[model samples]
Target: MAAKWQVVREMDANLIDTALVEAAYANPALRALFPLVSHGSLQFSRCTRFPWSQDLPSIFPYDGERHFRVRRLHEPRGSGREQIGGAVTADEAVELVASHLPPGCGPALDGTPDDLESLS
Candidate 1:
């Protein structure tokens, strides 16, 4: 899981989309979650299929099936508090997202080559 994640971090949008599409085709859980990610949309949204007006950072719709909605949000600028359940906090939530950290992203949000190295 980490390997794929790291490799994709260094990729461009086209590559990322292709990689995600391939992964979704193979993994049902990923299939449901991958598409809803808006292209180049920095702002987070709930991972729900049904729209509900709420100020939540994002939502991940989960069903009994292996496939479900899952979103990964990034932390704020220079904030030690990591994102927990899409909210900034010291404690780790069930999940966290590395948002807007694609290739050519800002230094603060960019995925470093070291991140890939560490995973290796």
Candidate 2:
């Protein structure tokens, strides 16, 4: 059986993550991307389906407390994420992420790039 403390810890994480996701969705810009909650981090992607690009940015709770960190995902492993900025609330964090979105990025594509290509 799972330990009680572990279960509680997971529940707490979920609550924090859910709140972050809700805040992200409230923004029209983020409502289109696929949102994911990992531990206390909130990550966004440009595709709703699988095989998401790892180059997108992620929002993490940082500064040893309630502060949020918006960062860019780095590839090739161990390169370290690029810090976008810090926010004190979920709304502020969402705004930071939304403001840094890729140029001309619209609502997330419905599927993989290949799926989009075939439509051309």
How well is each residue in 1-120 modelled by candidate 1, as lDDT tens digits? 334334444456542343333443343232223123334221222222234112223333233222223343334222232233433221111122333223332212123334423644
Off by over 4 Å in 1: 1-16, 32-34, 40-120
Model 2 lDDT on a 0 to 1 scale: 0.66
**Candidate no. 2 TM-score:** 0.70
Least well predicted 10-residue stretch by lDDT in candidate 1: 87-96
Once all C-alphas are superposed, what RMSD does model 2 give against the true structure? 7.2
Give me the runs in candidate 2 sitting further than 4 Å from their true place: 1-15, 74-79, 113-120
Worst 10 residues of 2 by lDDT: 1-10
lDDT of each: 0.31, 0.66
lDDT of 2 by residue, 59-119 (tens): 9987646678888856622458988887567778888888988775646676865564475
Clashes of each: 7, 0
Best prediction by TM-score: 2
Error at 94, model 1, angstroms: 16
